[model samples]
Target: MKRSIATLFILFSITIVKAQEIDSLSFIKSKRMSDDDLAKKREGTFFTGIPDFSSDPVTGFGFGLRTNTYWNGNRDNPLFPYTPYLAKLKANAAYYTSNARELVLSLDVPYYKGTRWRFKIDFKAQQNPANLYFGLTESTLGQLRLPSDENTTFSTYREFDRARKTLRPGGVGEADFVTDALSNRFRETEYMLNLKADYALGNGKWRIMGGYEIQHLSYTTFEGMEAEAIDPITGQNTTAPNGISLLRRDFEDGLISGVDGGWVSIIQTALIFDTRDFEPDPTKGYYFEIANEYSSKYIGSQFDFNKLFIQGRAYQKLPIGKRTVLAGRFGAGNIFGNNAPFFEFQDQWSPEGSINALGGRQSLRGYRANRFLARSMWFTNVELRVRLAETQIGKQRFAFAVAPFFDAGTVRDRWQDLNFKNIKTSYGGGLRIAWNQSTILSFDYGHSKEDRLFYFGIGQAF
Candidate 1:
């Protein structure tokens, strides 16, 4: 899986370079403008195109367009300082040459009313024609046993045969048992809307925040999984030979609750303490946030649950150079309810959706997305970031950085069941490019005992 993903990333890089050539003429035109025009473009609204190359286990190779509109709120309110009033609106659309498509639009207002308030809104719609799903648990590794012939029902016999074929050593079913296996092809459609407001308190060192979120999720079995298969005996209806059937049927049978999906509504509030000098790439300071979310029958949620989240991060500039810094983050989450939805149990969610707990590019870099999920989880990350170079192009400043990081985490069905000794660990290094002062592009590679993962995306991984 690592080798294939690396190769795909190389191909994606080459393709994006070619795609960026289409926008070179516009960039050159802007570079040739008068000094006053250039300064105006920098202070006012200016557009830039970024090469979009991303890959995941589910989305094989994705290439697309990301356009950013950057401007200063001070242009609209001269009383505000330009540094804190900088804002961005971004639109991203991409297609996985393999089997998926995604579109996202976001607005970030980091300094409303001169840093006294901050706001953000995001809208995303994605169609994953084929996505993978292992069972709902912390462990995907399982022992396989053949069924007994005596008094076995037909369903039981069929299940035994399916497992035998899928879980066999070095057989077609063997891939399912590997770290990359344990997957099914399903189509997912999701619509999410999030709104948050933060108010600064006591000389802007502390903040009070509130947010609301609504999400609609739908999933179905994708067709064409058996399109290439043929019956060996009768050459008709290649059903049993399809690998996806096993996993898809499990979902249909309610093996994991809420697989069909529905609506989820949540309201949350938090207290935050932040002293970071800069927001985009913090240099020296500490940030701590503790929050709670509630979903109830009165909130128009399909499930009733209460969730608690706490996260803290600290950054310190190294003595070696002003550009070198060490950062560490710790986070934990727990869900409480009679029967919470399995999807909500994922480690990606917090009071602030931007924070990640245990998986994906932002959290445990080596594991697959949502690879480990449970009722409760805790994770920590440490990284050393060194800025290597800085350059200016067409009134924009860019900084290149290298970061080496370590990550570890664990999850269990219940809080008491948590075993610190069973933690999963990964280590990796990454490259980053910061545009202007805020926007960031990152490429990272991570490795663990199970597999390796490569990620390319925007923003700092905190």
Candidate 2:
């Protein structure tokens, strides 16, 4: 949920049950539909309720159901040709095998009731038992070589340390403890509420956006390895081994705060200019936005911070071939104010909403989600999309395409320290399924120096 709605696993099932697009990233229109195409469009409410199932590396396997309803009204409506859907209501209840869970409800409306305004509201309760923390920024990458020597496993180190503690008792001569990859695991539970509104300028090409968001986040750090007395009767150690998690160590060292969690309330505004031919799967035109977010005590926020992000995306149809296009995006963001919470460093927000920065499917793709976190960051994505075929399925339009992409980014502890030096990169390709000109099912595999990741998502990454 830290990124666009496309990153949500529930979208996999929702897209399968029905086809529609209604979110921050999809609202503008740049092309006019022909009379014949408009005549074939469907009107009225489209409703569907079905069992939902999905599998992914982060959430494991999940099963649930969603109530998805769309109201498109008549083609005569002024917004019909411009908006993906006139209005939408979607609700979900689900559980994952990894002990993760979710309860969410969302609503979106564009050109509200013939007006020039757009509105969206979302509520969610999410639990991530496998949340990750890699110690922040480029430094975390070095930790992948933990234990130093190839022959030393984390388990052997822990056993040896336990023996040393048992022999030394409380003596100061004991060796300093060490942690490995498993130490990055933690638990996070969040309750979030978001409300957004957008007003169009005279030509409906420029927009002013405003929003409010609040989140209650709680975390559970790992329990460290402890020494225990041997059982007198059984003559065996009765305690289990546990190593201190990176999150716990950071809290103790004062590297991070708010372990118990608190309120993060923010007010956001942005100026956006868009001229995409299609919002869901843009084939031409450009989009730009500059967004600002402020969080302060006066806004009921327990943490204070000011963030600014500027981004641009462009799509061009390649003249070399039919149905071939080139798409590219570039973004840079920085957070000001010393009181910004650690979690805020992982995200970059715009009128299109937050995308996990520096890494992850929406950003670098090859790196793990939020593998790098810092106060300032920059990234770019470029992809070549070529349509392979198209067909009509019982009045529904379907098309398939293949996209080869490249991603790169870097992060810095401070905006003043930003540089291109140590940039991380990912290269990959994906298959895209366009359903009814709105929904897209995307499958991608990415590779980087540290990890290889596969992403199955609903819509274009931008």
Candidate 3:
């Protein structure tokens, strides 16, 4: 662990390159263009320079800086802790050129013209840790995205619960009802800082990309996350009364169990390869990517967790005598060493108790939230998309279209210790639009067999 952290630190301090020039993006001028016509125009470039670097879409490589601000909602509110406003920025440059050498080396993205190899130095800073993309512990993890509910297991719930308990308020033992809720707490403020780099091999048809990720996070949960009520140094439980507390409805049902102190460290190495010469295009927008990610804390496992993920994403444009497109992705995670939190229900008077639990956004969407859960959990997600309007309606900024999508995944508890076969699934879809190819508007309708959900956001599904 010490060696890994040292390597990352050395890599981060080693390079500073220039930014590459980026060409403009082009698209079909009409909603009526035939599929073949759209495919023929693939020669247009997003990279006008050797190594691509643009602050716009955040594509190429170079020495750049990025800042992300995530403003969640007020913590004193109710069930939901965040309102969701986010913006990310970066400054970077890169260069790439080919020589008649035995091995290829260029900082350019291998798929485009004049593009070679590309490398970048990136510094990310945020006063609020919750704004970070990933963290080691549950609380530090911030606005986490779990696998689909249909795929989650009881163990997943338990691991989640364990993490939540670290942040409970009201000192130690709170109300049964409130303790249960606090055990599944959410928080608002967090600050973070990160430094990393990206390296890509440009071969036109095949390319390999990988990099290092390091971050420091300070976060807070809606529920307090400390075990003792008083400060060990000052002799006081500094977080109480003002934070979320685990209170009882009557004292039989569990409310919250514990609160946590949100601080963690994460360091990872990533590697990915793209085949079939994938390029982003409106007409021939087809590509497939398969990647494996392994993450661990550079420091010891103070939070107790480790993760291994095998996932894949694919995109394709359909040609059924129409200029339509379809894109989707599927992913699953097998976690070990990490303790997910759940609930430990107490019966009327039986010392301690455990019945069963289920239901959350990660899976079982049709069921009420936290409806059922157990020991271990597994989850998966898949999305289907369509392109409605790609060409200009009248003015360049008037382009728009509609699409219906479907999403499904599940979670589980413990089924012979097999996470793959235990969870369930749900499906749904939505609509999208683009203005001058710069700004995109999206609305999606996601549903399970028994529940329907709507999501509003920006950009393409990819």
Q: Rate the local accuracy (lDDT) of all candidates.
A: 0.63, 0.71, 0.32
Question: Model 3 compared with the native: what TM-score?
Answer: 0.48
**lDDT head-to-head 1 vs 3, winner:** 1
Candidate 1 residues 360-448, lDDT tens each?
68778876666566777888999999999887886888889999999998877677776686888889999989887567788888887
Cα-based RMSD of candidate 2: 9.2
TM-score of each model, paired residue for residue: 0.75, 0.80, 0.48
Model 3 alpha-carbon drift over 4 Å, by segment: 1-115, 119-183, 193-202, 218-263, 275-305, 338-384, 390-398, 412-422
Question: Taking the tens digit of each residue's C-alpha lDDT, what string does model 3 give over 371-462?
Answer: 32323333333444444445644333334556654434333333345444424455555566654332445655555443454444334544
Tens digit of per-residue lDDT, candidate 2, span 1-462: 222222232233234224333443233445444343355456888764545465555666777876667787887766677666788788888888978899989898977876657899989999987666666655643424231132422223234333322321221222243223335567888999999887765466777777889999988864544434333345555543334566776777788766778888988777778887567787777899978788778879898778889899999988765578899999999888765777777789876657988677789988777777777889999999998988887766778999999999888877887778888899999999876656577888888766677877556888
Off by over 4 Å in 2: 1-41, 48-55, 65-68, 141-181, 224-240, 320-322
Question: In model 1, how large is the Cα lDDT of residue 13?
Answer: 36
